[model samples]
Target: MSIQMEDCLLSYKTALMAVGAAAAYYIIRWFLWQLTVGDYDRKYVFVTGCDSGFGKLLAKRLDSLGFHVFAGCLTEKGVTDLQTGSSGRFKAILLDVTKSEDIAMAVKIVKENIPPGTGLWSLVNNAGISGPLGFPDCFTRKHYEQVLDVNMYGVIDMTNAFLPLLREANGRIINVASVLGRISIRTCIPYTISKHAVEAYSDGLRRSLRSQKVSVHILEPGLFKTELFNLDLIMKNIYKDFDAAPAETQEYYGRKCLKDFTWVVKLMGFASSQFHKVVNSHVHAITAKYPKYRYLVGYDAHCYFWPLMYLPEWISDFCLDIEFVPPAGAQKKKNN
Candidate 1:
């Protein structure tokens, strides 16, 4: 072979070797990650938002794994749904995470149910609200508070209330954030803000609680086909916010424009139907001998949003803005 051809062949061989090494490393890592703490009998798990979605699924999954599950539901119907045809090990607690009284009552209930001297193995803070969808300027303080109450404050309160129990068991605390937490978008302003708070809180918590042998894990899941992602419900919220805006603001962004924007949002249907990925992350956080501090669930979360977060702000902003259709009567369009 000519010298140039020989060098090219060597480069290819070196690249192949590097690729092989990476594959081998990941294969070994996967096996190591499979190590789990297997005593399910004495372990008890508590999950919030069992009314539907991930909370309900996780509670049921843990119950199936033979752990006593304390499923917290906001409504009587939620409680009933989880209890009906479920294993006796599943204890449904009427919990409204936003209410201090309800949280206190839940603490009592969890304590009463778990065996004395045994601590809770996991406390999954899965309750969250999508909040009202609107342009950032359209939202009032109340709109932000409503989401923060459940998504941020609720997580804090639950973690604090359950810390003692978790410490006793050297347990895990799993808080559900979102891919939007890492990167902000024009939509779901309140929800994104709350999740960012969750990410911060979880990190601070993990570091502070290290001495106590309590681990905190944050789950950053992309949009999923959950009740929170219901398009009709989202549209209703958007309309409500739009109507509530000032007349001048309404005129600036006409209803037709708003509708078109929402239509664009609908077209970008990135919500994954595979709910198991999130549930599996929760399970690993709870049962693994060593769990990741942050679990980025779903391809959108792992491959898209997470990577976007690490890019330059201008670049990320450009990429995210591609999906955003300018509303009717936008000043920029008028200028154009």
Candidate 2:
């Protein structure tokens, strides 16, 4: 056989070996990922935003799995509902993440309630609000601050308040971000900004807490049937903000642009009704002996938003532009 042909055969064999090794590595990882902590009753989890959505669902789930759960709710009804038929292990405290008093009160309640010896096993920062969904300039700094207070700063405050407990248990922090953190959209500027901040904060916290034996994981879920995606409520808020805009700003944008807010409806049409994906991701992040540092949940997150995040900046901008509804004045500015 010719020397060149032998070299080619050798290269083929090397590629096959590499493929086999890669396959084996992933298979082992998949198996190990399924391993979970056995002491459910000893593990305590604190989950915020239990008033509704993923937070509420996860609280119930962990309770069923025998973990002592501290569910931070925003309303009396939220507190009453969870405590009504739930196990004694499930305690719901009225907690609005935006308020310093609420957070401090919650910290006291958690400290008072935690079982003897075990510290908090997980802290899930899930409370968030969908900010005004209109043009960026249509809202003020206060508008942005409202959302950030819950989504970004709230996470920071919760983590800081509970770090001592987490360090004691060598526990983990599971923050709920969004795919929007990786890719920004024009209409949801405040929400996008907050999630992006969360991504950065989670990364930094994960690194900083390594010595403390505190693992930080982030969940970047795509759109889902959560309160944050309530369409009618969202539209109402958007139009409210639009109406409040200065007269000149309104004239420039034109009422016609409000019609384009249909883009939000279309976008939300893709929201998955499978709440379990997010809830399960939270459970895994809490219970799995070797949980992933980042959990990207939902079909849209895995198949579309995550992939789009890696594309060239121009390409991503183009894709996002296709979804953005421009203001009436945008054309005039472009023409000039």
Candidate 3:
């Protein structure tokens, strides 16, 4: 009878231990969630490229969550839309990312608008350009330079201009990079190169700011439905410039290249989203107490692309090719 009683006592103790462990896990999980979501009250954030896409949606989300949002757009129409749609929480400012003068004006506005001691809490470097799409060999020096000016140098100038404010507030810098930054694909060399540069810049900045309490985060989103994939615009531009090609260039690729290219471009448009996933990742990175250094946003980003980042370049290329077919009726060319 005593042995049976002792066995019961052991079972009771095991049950109590299991309950304690489960409770501890719950508490830890709650703490982590809180840490990641952060406090949304009274914080201020600045976002660029508010004209459309992720920037517009992110600005709205942040403003709705009670953040003071300073949204920058390149055009008057964008400014009007943001001002009209949002409550008094958002202030739309005109900013052409490539223009230093516009950048200066934006900085001045931020200094004047944000109350003294409030500082500029976060700078979302969401402004970027996806330059002309074609084979890497097809791109000219001018095209590469133009893309770098807007995508790479523009980011650098903005960050430098706003560094003082960010330092004062001990806030975060969220750069909207791309999965292309981590993995290069065919026919997107200019954009891929620029994004790769951005990744390096963000990493260097993160390490440099470690001692200063400033956090740097990168938002690496896969494909999303946006004006970037406007089929009509792409075809119009390509056709308009087709005659400008050298005689040799025309002979090499032939007319079928353009048709196939358009098909693939249209396919990408259908595959991506009208509603971008980058906005959620951007908000979390900006507001979270301990924001992760890098966030891979989009369904395919985490599921497919990111894992391939670890593979050899040839393997990655093979994997990407299988997933994305070349434009219809365009055969793979033989090496010279």
Candidate 4:
């Protein structure tokens, strides 16, 4: 053979080998991804924050798949509506996660329905609030408390209450943490703290519960439209929280803070409207033979937020904060 022909054959062989290797890896992964689910038809799943958003949709998703679903909703209206819409495979419990009595009642409700051995299949912590928005000083300690109560403490209280049932079934706990949980953002301190705490708590729970065979997974999804992202509610809260501050505080921050804050809200105008991505992750975490420890859903989550999370602190700070312009008051102060 001529020298060029030999070289061409060698290159073709290398490319073929790479393709074969890639195809084999994906096939193995596909097998592992198959549902090795237990008797879901008989098993029970308790999902909180099902009154709306991802939780509501997930409860429906699991119900359709044959699991006896226990949905925890925060309001009578939500409960009534969810029940009316579902196929009678799922039951709704009035669960205000901040209330200990409510949590106890939810536990009792789920336990009473199933036989002793069936036990709970999954606990999805999906209820959360956006809380009041502003620079940290614009809100009070009470404001922070309210956000933590639902987003962070609610998850803890609910998990602790249901751990025994999950242990009995050797099931799964899927906690919904966000990209914000991994990396702090411009505002949203209380939310960031709560989610970060959740990430830490989930890590600890996963390690400790391994011997019990209760797998724990964390779902981190980027911006998506839900009540949490409702623009009217967001803008209303912004004015309500920030406007209520003392005159001095408002002047210090200036009118421009409000403008920039609204800008941030508007930026979310393009956030994904689909909730299926997160719900699908929830389903996999429950049914897959060996589910992932962390599922990063959405393009924004995988392409941007994940990488930004690992950047060095100084670099991220500059990228996220320093280059950005300050509010009008801060700018004036700098000049003076």
Using lDDT as the measure, the top candidate is 2
Give per-model TM-scores: 0.91, 0.96, 0.84, 0.90
Tens-digit lDDT track of model 1 for 146-216: 99999999999999999988988889999999888888888778989999999999999999999889889
**Full candidate order by TM-score, most accurate first:** 2, 1, 4, 3
Q: Report the alpha-carbon TM-score of model 2 versus the true structure.
A: 0.96
Model 4 spans > 4 angstroms off: 1-26, 322-324
Residue 269 C-alpha lDDT in model 2: 60
Best by TM-score: 2
* 169-221: candidate 3 lDDT, tens digit per residue: 88889988899999887767888899999999999999999898788999888
Which tens-of-lDDT digit does each residue in 1-336 have in candidate 4? 999999999999999999999999999988888857667787788898998889989999998988899999999988998888676678987999999999999999888898987778889998898887667888788988998899899999999999999989888999999988899887678888888988999999999999998988999989898888778888888888878988887887777767777777677779987789999989999888889999989888888778888989888787677434476777888899
Q: For each candidate, what is the lDDT?
A: 0.89, 0.90, 0.81, 0.87
Clashing pairs in model 3?
A: 225-273
Clash counts per candidate, in order, are 1, 0, 1, 0
| Count of clashes in candidate 3 | 1
Kindly give the stretch of ten consecutive residues in candidate 2 with the minimal lDDT sum: 261-270
Which 10-residue window of candidate 3 scores lowest in summed lDDT?
327-336
Q: Over 4 Å off in model 2, which ranges?
A: 323-325, 333-336
